[model samples]
Target chain A: MRRNRALLILLAVAFGAAFLKAGSFPGVAAFVPAPATHIAATTAHVESRFASSKLHTQVHAASAIELKDGTVRAFWFSGSREGAADVTIHSAVFDPQLGRWGKETVVASRESTQHGLHRYVSKVGNPVPARTADGRLWLYYVTVSLGGWAGSSITAISSDDEGLSWSAPRRLITSPFANISTLVKGAPFLYADGTLGLPVYHESFSKFAELLRLDRHGTVIDKQRLAAGGQGSLQPVLLVQDAQRATVLTRYSGSEAPRRARTMSTQDGGQHWSAPVASALPNPDAALSAVVLADGRWLAALNNQQAGRDSLSLMLSADQGASWRVVQVLEDQRGQAAACEPRIDAALRQSDLAVAHAAPEVYAGYRDSARVKVQSGGACNFEFSYPYLIQTRAGDFHLLYTWNRVFIKHLHFDTAWIEQRLREAAP
Target chain B: MMAYTDLTGLAGVAFALGVMLSRLPLISRFAVARSWLVAGIMALALLPVSDLSLAGYVRGVSGDLSVTSLLLLGLTLLSRAHPQRQGLLLLVAGAALALYPAAMGLGSFDPYRLGYGGYAALAALLLLALWHWVRGNGLIVLGLALAVSAWALGGYESANLWDYLIDPWVAIHALFALGRAGLAALKRRGGAR
Candidate 1:
């Protein structure tokens, strides 16, 4: 009995150590290398009619691409609140030479749903756009039909002449539930074979992640799941190193403890995935955004606090996601709000702020605080919101998150800032 | 590295710690006290009844199946039964509790997955072993069979049957309750002698 008890103690210690080591939270360094010299460049410029309108509410999940004419065009969904009927896909263009953003244009609207979904839309969400290798830009967004968010479908539109005009919206029927299971989050990855791997998830009895492959023209080809059953892994973020191998990271939303960030790998070009294993990241049931940096590192923006969005941080991971070093507090509550203006000015001094000139017109929209009522169990309290990320060609990062229920605050920064901070940390 | 801070994971850690604490030599001497203490900690860890305000709609969704609540309710019923019957009753009750989550899901509702994290699986196995050690009380064994049936029949609409039928919280409650009943039976037998 004594020997048995001693063995149990040993086993318990070993188990505890293993769990702690697997999480790897305590000892990782939280600093990065600062740049030797800082040369600021205007990484992003927001030019949209919604920016100055009372109808302007929330701008979220934006994707930006630089056109052949040196014009940077950004596409994102703006609505009264996230996943609302007023939510529509909007766009603006930035002319690098002019150093200004141009007028905003509506790409997809609730009226567009009447043509595509064959039903009056109740809400729209999560617009993600990508510029194909052939220069055609494709936009993907979600539209709900009957029930709550679970009853949704993905729709796509293409712009051949950049942001000047777009193809009429069409539904991409990707799920067995007609369209209920498909929702896009991350920027669509253009596979080497020219197929688009759009990250999506199902909200049925089983909330699992899927990689929906589409043709270059935005036709659904094949679908694959990231994890099996109801482990609640959704919002898959693709980390592409090359064509043959890729890693898909997802957020865990099940009743499982530790609510980890689940990760799986694919070698056969995303046809199948290895079983998802837990990563050492903490997820408190909030959305996360990740982008692959030019240097092969990854930048992930997430709420660092255990519970609220009060402390949003930008973290850099040099070794895939095995470890992370903090880049900076992008939007912590403690920083001086006045510091924002100077920071913008300082960044602009080092970099040229791209702006575009467009013919101004009379933009008409209502600005009423409508007390909209929702069904019994849906999210009701309405407000504008934003949470999006995009990586520019010049190795800079552009982020857009909601600034209260007001305007969408756009932030632009580069590797130089990160390197500078890392150098400052060096003793 | 990723940072996680949810009670679900903490519950597993607490269960591991409770298991370690219960096996310690010094703590083992005060078996009843140790059992209650371990049960209390496990209950606190598993159910965020205290944080109901913060958990909001999710708390209402998960309901309550804490270790202390299950063990205390089981012991209260066993105290009224005959000594031999009390042990049988504890075993039966534990099996019911362990199997309840797996068969019914977390509560009588949501069952797409197991309700009580990974601990439920361990708990179920432990109860099954205890039922076997008791030489198989016919009714207790019948209860186990019924729990298994509930698990099988629950289906997609039934949540995951494994979690419904057997869970760690249920197993812990059963073992501790059975232990208490066995001690009571032994004392009665000794007195008669």
Candidate 2:
């Protein structure tokens, strides 16, 4: 009888506990915070490594554009790294009206024995496709023939029918290796006289940004250095307002303290530039991108953190690359608590103090959950880096950034969203 | 706060009841009963308010299994044998797996990010434990506890060897519960026979 009473008490306790647990279900609903009120204005789609054929792997350094009939076209390189024997240029188009990316087509590969040189070319890098001022669509990309990224040459293929077909790839012969200077980050600026200003960069032992001028018939007339010296800067993005005055934002590659962003200005139609100055931004020695806003502002995508790439930030500069105000934080992964304690415990068990010291650095670098910095009024200290921005005709900003090297995140927002937030802050 | 409040209340009640029940010799007598108690403990650990219950929190800290899912799955299948075979297979597989990161000079890719969110880590760990249990090593019970403790602590960088050895996954808990329940059902039927 006494045992039965004890059993009854135990049953009562279990029932009571389960009742309370089930009652707590409402609490689970409260943990999820409210979603963002404004939707992103710009939409970004990733053209991953194998958007085309599986037979040939290795795809990187991509550029895209949205055509007049709402067709989005993208171009990239495929082969075996930067200097393998099987490198080739590939292109794809996205028909937005039909809501599908077109079939992947090969644009250029190694020339046949009848048409070209004997040595095997390994890979290609950095493809730039643009519509010229005369309505001719031009595709300019690099092919590496001999060495690493240093022994690369730029070539062009034109399509008069908006990429349905293309002319044979022709070597530009832009550099000293008879066409072997790395010509990348090509953005065409249409001069008042209908000429083209191509922003190119060299990446031998001395990495420098240069501006090349070409006639309408794809003839290279002249060129000049935008920023010189071996600061390891490449990808000079040009923002030209008129024929004479322009600004070029170059990605910093040097590994020194207070990492600088090289910038220059042309006052004489791609003739001369002011000495490149390091901007007040921290770069962990990686490539960066920038684009001009329609309102005459500049948007830069880069790693804002001093040491790691965990924080990718997007900044808007009213003055050309001088000072930047962070518009948004794309990714900010904080560390987890559950996994940290036992790792510390294991370190203690092993009595390895050295490994323990390095553990925190490893934890900080690998933690995937990131926080977006939204609180305003002070200079944005949050990390927002490696940004690529494109402004649409509908006045929306489309931005894409590498989210901790795990995935690429696309952020789209409009001027109205910024204006609305600013108006709300005025009170 | 209410979610946390409910979670703490439920956990406190369950823990207090478990402690009280465990004091009674009758409840502790049977292995099947003890296994049920373990299931209850796992459910308690999953309270929404607990740090281990968050999806992104776990994945970021624990890593993902997407890249090595096939390999882990294969190991899971191989370990489901008799106790001696299970132990041997686990040792061989564990040694190979542990050395793979170092040998390839490949840094730890967070496997927690790979699969469906929320229960991925729990599932992977449980599957691993099930493989151990089927081999009848009986060390799976201890492993389950260690794994849960490691996961609860957020698997952070500390001076502890236990963190690297165990991981909390749903499959581990479910497998333990299922295996114990299956054994209990078999014994009951056999007694009748």
Candidate 3:
């Protein structure tokens, strides 16, 4: 009886604790946010600039935010090459008035990351920087201590003075399976309650996207899967329609043919999501970004090709995300544009004059910096991928993406310009 | 916030490294090998390898050691008590097959994501531990109880219940041990024949 009593006590304590651990922390209903009701100064505008100057040999995955003074700060990872030891996260300020980008400087490196985290960091990449509701700038990037991208985790650091200085980096506990395989790509958005919803994805045993709801301090409070399984989606780009309605566009990685971009929407403020359905836009398994227009439409920058990322365009979706139509050919490197470089020495001019005009000297420098990355299967490739889009309070769309895996091209267009393009696409 | 994570890493590395050092011939010759092993464990935790401790580097790659893993490593430390090896091996092997391959994106359900929402899996664990406890399997019962209690206290960095229960290393070792046991059983039958 005594032995049985002791066993019962142990079991009771553990069971009681387990019941309490069921942590049904009264599902906090999604706070209804006051609709974003700011109409910016409607000036027709469109311009292009390279946010990253001759700072690093290779650069990719650029995300940007408009500062308080209206200058744009863009962040991208650069190094001798991707995954190289010298790889570091760098940023630049885009002074729209001057029509030029400030000098690029390294923000986070492997050394700084390991030092701040107090752990061994093998590499870091894919910076997703955003302004929190409380006016601080938070940068969430990918970190790996072992293996490839499959063994990745998300690390976050914040700057109170808008990218002037940073707090020590802390690893976000995203997964239970050794906290491995959570990566950031899409833009993080703010909740009505000053919390944040960071869109992340799993690349380990699966290729599904997840939404991690974090408190103000960056602690993950909840996670909701946008899709499931390897056949699901990756790199989600979110757009909010209202307090309870939101949509997510993802890179389709399905086994089936007729590969279209996958999309899902949440009706209950993201407590759950409808199954991912196929969108009309073709997805060649690449990353993309979207922003909500002042007029309530959504615009996305993506490589619209079925095979290569050689063609990038802006697609407008007037019906939330049900349909999409290309309003502008942001980049077209097909046909003659995909010509082999003439003798490696002659200045490599882009087929698109806009890109050529944006950076005549960029092509000359890219050959030496990212020679190996641009060469695919012994062919010279024109590439544009990993688009990051943000709409400033002044109703300007700032789109940034990798230019030939060497430069981060920032495209600035205003709401008036977007309206014109949308009107032209109208039937 | 990181102390619990670091402490768990330290304990795990101590047990694993201590057992490994105890196997050295020079150390094994001594009657007080364990004492020396304990001292060595402390040094390994504090001993910096490129500024971070050896244990910290291991933790960086491995993340937190699951309760099951720590318990298994501790078992290797204590002198032989192998009464429940078959049952534990079977459980580990079965869980690895169920959780890993599917969680790798093969199955419809991630089962791993079930870690964050709540501890619905704990009830089943309670039943399993109870049966094991009735059968006098203190090691398995204690491991399960401790895992639940630790997770309940919310000290772990991960909110997932599965994280506390099993990790990749423990699962892989369990499969290897089970496979070895099967081969040994086959050899015994062949010898009998």
What lDDT, from 0 to 1, does candidate 1 have? 0.54
In DockQ terms, which candidate is top? Answer: 3
Q: Whole-model lDDT for model 3 versus the true structure?
A: 0.77
lDDT tens digits, residues A319-395, model 2?
76678777655455334344443433442223222323556754333222211121123322222334545555555
Q: Please, what is the whole-model Cα lDDT of each candidate in the order they appear?
A: 0.54, 0.49, 0.77
Report the C-alpha lDDT of model 3 over A1-427, residue by residue, as the tens digit.
5665576677779778877757543355463332464765676788776677663378889999889999999999998878887889999998888877888888899888876665678999999987777788999999999988888999888999989888878788777566788899999888877778889988986788888877776767677667767656998888887888888899887766677888888888887788888888888888888877756788899988767788799988888777888878987667755346552222223322333554646554555544555665687777889999888776677999988887788888877787788787779
Ranking by TM-score: 3, 1, 2
Lowest-lDDT window of 10 residues in candidate 3 chain A? A343-352
| Every model: Cα RMSD to truth | 18.7, 29.1, 3.8
TM-score of chain A of each: 0.73, 0.68, 0.88
Q: Candidate 3: misplaced stretches above 4 Å?
A: A1-34, A68-70, A97-100, A131-136, A191-195, A337-379, A424-427, B1-4, B24-27, B117-119, B127-136, B186-193
Q: Identify the candidate with maximal lDDT.
A: 3
What's the best-to-worst order under lDDT? Answer: 3, 1, 2
Q: Give the TM-score of candidate 3.
A: 0.87
By DockQ rank, best first, the candidates go 3, 1, 2
* TM of chain B, each: 0.31, 0.28, 0.86
- Tell me the tens digit of each residue's lDDT in model 2 across B1-193: 2223223323433343444455457756756655466345436434444223322122222222111221233233343433443343344345334433321112222121121112344455555555554544444333443434432432322111222332222224334545676799999999999
Q: Using TM-score as the measure, which candidate wins?
A: 3
